[model samples]
Target: VALADLGRLPVTFATVDPVALIRNAVWANSRRAKAQSVSVEPGQLPSTTVLVKWDGARIEQLFTALIESSLRYTPAGGRIAL
Candidate 1:
């Protein structure tokens, strides 16, 4: 799923700990594929704002989809970020 889609969700909002989410996404993705590696870095935005609002479960699903997609195309030793 695209970040834009997540942003468009009515129940999703800006997270205070975006880095933690990124870390979790990476870790979860790494567990699913042995040939791929995952990493996350802090990103910057113009300002902190709630672009969308969603529950935690939906966010997890979105991340899972993203990781699966990455694993499909990424070569061994390559990295995927969320």
Candidate 2:
């Protein structure tokens, strides 16, 4: 569905917390990082939720892609704070 949306589909925008998204992205990619012995965790986050209007799925995909790319380059025993 996400791939199909790439064909100029209208973005489903809504209020979302970016910090929560970051944490979720970290969790989603943690297993791969563990397999490589690299620590993947969320950095310090704001105490209050930061809301924004955007396509949540696309934002998540972007975060996941960035983290996966980092995992590909980071050495074993390295740390990545998203």
Candidate 3:
């Protein structure tokens, strides 16, 4: 099933903002952050807009994985800056 879904994965194209994408990913994982006593901070996101065409869903998933992996080693009351 998972293998089949790989071929069907929705690939989308849109102008994506890196900062907003990071912020959205952090917001989406807020619950986990609270539970783990981990704080996610959005650092100096470039004031100059960054535009890239890509699959937003896949990017979100990537951020989720990255955050989750960080949570593994991050102690309580830790912070993650993007």
User: For model 2, how does the per-residue alpha-carbon lDDT over 1-82 read when each residue is reduced to its tens digit?
Assistant: 6656787666799999899889999999999999999999888888888699988888999899999999999999999997
For residues 10-76, write the lDDT of model 1, one tens digit per residue.
Answer: 5545434444455566667666676444333223533554434445556776777777886788777
Clashes of 2: 0
Task: Give TM-scores for every candidate, taking all chains together and pairing residue i with residue i.
Answer: 0.51, 0.86, 0.79
Off by over 4 Å in 1: 1-16, 36-53
Q: Root-mean-square deviation of each candidate, in angstroms?
A: 6.6, 2.9, 2.5
> How does model 2 score by TM-score?
0.86
The number of clashing residue pairs in each candidate reads: 6, 0, 0
Question: After TM-score superposition, what is the CA distance of residue 21 in candidate 1 from its true location, in Å?
Answer: 2.7
**Between prediction 1 and prediction 2, which has the larger TM-score?**
2
Question: TM-score order of candidates, best first?
Answer: 2, 3, 1
Candidate 1 lands at a TM-score of 0.51
Residue 76 lDDT (model 1): 71
User: What overall lDDT goes with each candidate model?
Assistant: 0.58, 0.90, 0.82
Instruction: Flag the better candidate by TM-score, 1 or 3.
Output: 3
By summed lDDT, the worst window of 10 consecutive residues in model 3 runs over: 1-10
Per-residue error at 18 for model 1, in Å? Answer: 3.8
Q: Model 3 Cα RMSD, Å?
A: 2.5
